[model samples]
Target: MDKHLTPGHVICLINPVTVNLSHNILVINCGSSSLKFAVIDPESTQVLIQGIAERLNSPDALLKVQPLGSQAIPYINHAKAMAAILASLGDIPIAGIGHRVVHGGEFFSASVLLNEDAVAKIDACRALAPLHNPAHVTGIRAAMENFPELPHVAVFDTAFHQTMPPHAYFYALPYDLYKTHQVRRYGFHGTSHRFVAEQAATLLDKPFTELQIITAHLGNGCSACAIKNGQSMDTTMGLTPLEGLAMGTRSGDVDPNLIQFLVEQTGRDIRQVTDLLNRDSGLLGLSGLSNDMRTLLEAADNGHSRAELAIDVFCYRLAKGILGLAAALDRIDALIFTGGIGENSAPIRARTLAHLKVLKPTLDHDLNSAHGRHTAGRITTTDSALTALVVPTNEELVIARETQRLLQP
Candidate 1:
């Protein structure tokens, strides 16, 4: 394998003489109510096109497609959406399809080509991820129905974090409960965190086995992870995504009794409480306005008391989580920021790193404002011990690479 010359950008220059697989691959990532799809070239590790079908099984469903070298096209429902996506492929002959399946449930350790047995194994773990797995199965089944001849593979989100040691993943609960129900911390954002950490390693001109870093994915669902020697030592999210940092609407960490308290006081059912925690909380709950951080920040700047408090709390929790993650890494080399809030919100980023002044994370005030996709540069000052980078996370590329690896014998 010939490595590309660019730093942090290496492409395996397969000579075709040693390869037995096809060049083109399609990656499918299905979420709770959405399906995200991509067509990629495994040789160059480039995504040619991408699309998403959102609000599936609902009336307000819509599909959006950004065709290869073209603008985005929006559609309605999964069936129509898939057809549009297929149409967007044009003459790009797809060799194989790889899917992103959440919660592999200790069954899948790496990307596996999908077969009847593998599909059944994925189906069996539905209870572990009621919101995600069903939609994933549905989307994969749709792909199977549409492209029966192509080889299909399943790449898991939880698979990357499987390297997490027992201490980091295990909960302080009964052994029987964990064994019987598979109740333990299965960190989400594994794909993104793993992808960026690898990117960090590449940028640092270091191998994964020699790097120690912290990756913060601060999108709607946020989490901090400590990666030591390319393995997840600890992550903010535990048991479920709801257990992490304050998100768009999901209340991050809450009192265990709060659920019971709300249920009894409001005379609501379990599902109602679940909706509140997952949809009506977080910045939305605190500000009582919007879940969006940008709008919250704007309002906060205008002297909106609740919005200010929400912003403060969000940054504080994020910093606190990073401190804990740093402790896990023992020594920090790079601190990566990705996702929506992490990449764009300079104020939020500043607030987060300001608390880490002792860690000597100096912001290149100018550079922080211009951060964007795939651009990883130093945001820290000259005197800082640790490096702060806005390394954009590319989970799709990670999935595509894993797909390529699985296809090769």
Candidate 2:
């Protein structure tokens, strides 16, 4: 790492070992049974190539690539999948690699160059993120093995939120639980929030470090963040992704006693009840329809009572949550929306802003409608009190930029 580096003036240096030649970053995001990756040009933030290796170690394991198509790779594990990914790269040059690790816990506060000690620290944080951290470690090791010479960086989803104040992150639970077991509100979707916040700052023509913004990343998995002066002051999601907004299948913000209550009344075990909330609840549970927001919106328009109620609850809760996050900041410079639902769903945006009557956020209906898929910009009226936008987030691009920044010499 270089001792003298300036913001927005990062110079990608040549390494003696790998001789860094290009400015492209290979961004890898690993799930429990899938690896979604992209080759991004950090300078332009363009996705040069994108693909995924799915159902790893299963009989139906398959590898899919854009502009290349799909094919089955039998009994494909993470290492084999990584090898196939590297093999398919052909002549596209890569300067560095960026990996998305879901939970860094209290270990990493920012993106770090992957090494033995870094890997060990990441693994240690797995006690809190049992399901995600292990798979990330597997993918990191696999990528390191495949691209041994290239520098690899771990861009944590939790790293950006490590700046959160203890009062905001701590729950009302026992103090000993936080000290000993490391239990607290470690928010997710931080990468998306940070990306959109920076974009908001750019669009607002203000320094990110001086801007107070609220970002909502509402996809299948949803989370809201209150960013003050480029730092995560407070966020909705806590401990796990399941604690935030009501997601596609997650019943967010449920009663703490509901789990045991369901166990006693329904005769299901604690695990079963918990799974119900995590998997079977949310929009699907509320409407008894598909988890797809589009489907619910269409059904609601068709006079489906349950679907209408589901959409109502989703928008109400979302609006309420957004307004609630404002308490963390003195005044919000911008309330930006990103992710699938946040970016594309015009109705959701309108409905959400409608509930924010106190903020007097006037929406440009035409502008909101104009911001469909592949389009993003401000959607608030010029005279509106708040500047609300529909900024489409690119987590891979953010990871690539972070990789480039960390690779500076």
Candidate 3:
């Protein structure tokens, strides 16, 4: 225990059920329409309870708890969802609360204890991440109101990539726009990227500080990170999450002039056009069917031409991003794939890796297809110069650990 801990902070040491306070940390990840919550024991890295509140603020709001069950609860807003989550936990002791905030801007480079000042800073960054930070603020306020006594910590998605050099994070836009408005690449999924990179080090039995790795988080939201010597040297998602590889609905890396061209052609307002790119483009727009990769894959297999095109574009764009990020590294050590499409889709993996012949990566078909349920290990041949792996990311665990560290006695 640290000497900084006072008697007021000793309540965290107590168990919710009067059994033994097992040091359970409650991790919350609030999205625009849903909230994912988990109670994890950091000591053993075990998840005691995990669930999601979906369709929040809508009539179809639902709460699903793993290992328990689910119910259609009327969660009018994130506050109600947080209340329901607390009620579902019964008496499980929560040593602390960890909130996943998507963008911390350039102000925060690491996780910090949540205080009024911290909340204010996060609120100030709301404009930088209009789609995410506002929802995060809502969740934070609710959690702070509900668990006023417990220590609350905020773990940012953009924190890890703060190590990127100016040349890497800066755009070609006017220097004044960057200096005045803080317009630059602030990568998302830092927790996921960092978690898998460290896990890669353990799996390969190499010093993390001596490796150059590229991590691709492929899901509804995708980004590729270039990490050198255990620090983020560069990443794909820039300023916002919409600048990386084409996501489920996001049009990644579009030309700046496209906005003006669309505005002129469609006569839609800027916000509407932005919404179209962020919510109705990518796989959904290209396939004219769904934003889900599974659905696209199925359609492609059934000879759906548009679906096939969507998948091809996704893979090609992802490969390009990976190869481009590789330039930030002196040598390629491993190319790690995580997230939904990365961990589960063998065909997607094979398609993406096919374009990376320059790295000499050889994927074992059996190993790539056999790994199930977010298992972490190599999916490439042992002799391959650049190893490929499918390491499932646990951002919640990272949040929990950060919270516990901040609250340690």
Candidate 4:
């Protein structure tokens, strides 16, 4: 354990009901209207089960639960879904519960065990993450109600980025506003980026502190981070999650004045504009079709003009973000791709990197397509100036590991 651990605060969760160090740790990751969970044993880091709750707060919300290496089973409501999920755990004793919380603010810099005061603290910051916090609160409450005997830990997405220096995090806003409301660039996807960066360092057999990395997490919600010395020097996401690479349904990096312009021109309410930006923008808005990249790629392959434009724009923004990140890092030791689109979409990866000719990143097309989760290899040509890799992010494992570490007495 690091000497920075607060005595009596970091609870050691070595022994569970049977005094055995090997215990099943439950990890829950909740978004605005979805909850993704996994169960893992600390002894081997083996995933025992995994599940997801989608469309929360909707009458037609659904959940898909799956045991380790098994097919998923869908359920109607989150409550019933959670019940079915718990029952599916069979007789496995739940040692602890770890939750992925969105915004931890300036107060929490590391993972902490959830108690009443901590829960209250989380509740107080609902305004900071209007979409994410309520769902997190709901999931945590459900977990508490269902398993009153277990120790629930809050593993924050913002925690890993806490190592960011003040210059990188602070905004040039009014002093009182920052001091009173905590308005600053609080980067999300810290968990995924941190996990991938560490994995990349290990794969390269290089010390983390010596590596300058730029990690692109390109899923439904996309973000890039500039990691220097294993710490977040800067990230694409700002005060909100809606600030990074153009996402599935988000208008990432839009002009701030556009909001006012749209409001004046369309005479629509702010809520409507917010909904448009958050729910109806990005690839879906651009392509005039599905938000999924695979669907867009298919449409483009079949001569869909809008889809082609959408793909081009997405890659353009991605490459630009990478360039910015590279500038932040001074020089890039490795450029890693992770997330749904990043890991699986070889064409997307190739297109994104092709624009980086100025940086001399040569992509080996064959390796990019062959690489998958658990396989880390260089996709860059031997003579390429920069190292390009495909690394799968493991945020769940980070959550479980943090839970075990914080709970260990």
The number of the candidate with the highest lDDT is: 3
Models 1 onward score TM values of 0.88, 0.93, 0.92, 0.89
Clashes of 2: 0
lDDT of 2: 0.86
Using lDDT as the measure, name the better of candidate 1 and candidate 2. 2
Candidate 1: lDDT of 327? 71
List per-candidate RMSD values in Å. Answer: 5.7, 6.3, 6.4, 6.9
lDDT of 3 by residue, 353-380 (tens): 8988888888888888874323347888
TM-score between candidate 3 and the true structure:
0.92
Q: Candidate 3, clashing residue pairs?
A: 1-409, 2-409, 185-239, 186-239
Q: Candidate 4 at residue 223, lDDT?
A: 94
Q: Compared with the true structure, what per-residue lDDT tens digits does model 4 show for residues 171-242? A: 887878888888888899989999899999999899998889999999889999999988888888888888
Which parts of model 2 have CA positions greater than 4 angstroms off?
1-21, 372-376
Residue 347 of candidate 1: its Cα lDDT?
A: 93
The deviation in Å at residue 397 for candidate 1 is 1.1
Q: Which run of 10 residues does model 3 get worst, by summed lDDT? A: 2-11
Q: How well is each residue in 1-409 modelled by candidate 1, as lDDT tens digits?
A: 1111111322333344544335678888776666677676766666555666676667666655553232333435555556667876776677888898887888887788899899988988898888888878887888887889988888887887788888888989899978999898888888989988988898778898889999999987899899999898889987778997988899998888998999999999988999999999989999999998999999999999999988888998898889887777768988999887887788998899888867877677787777733345567765778788888777767777777787787
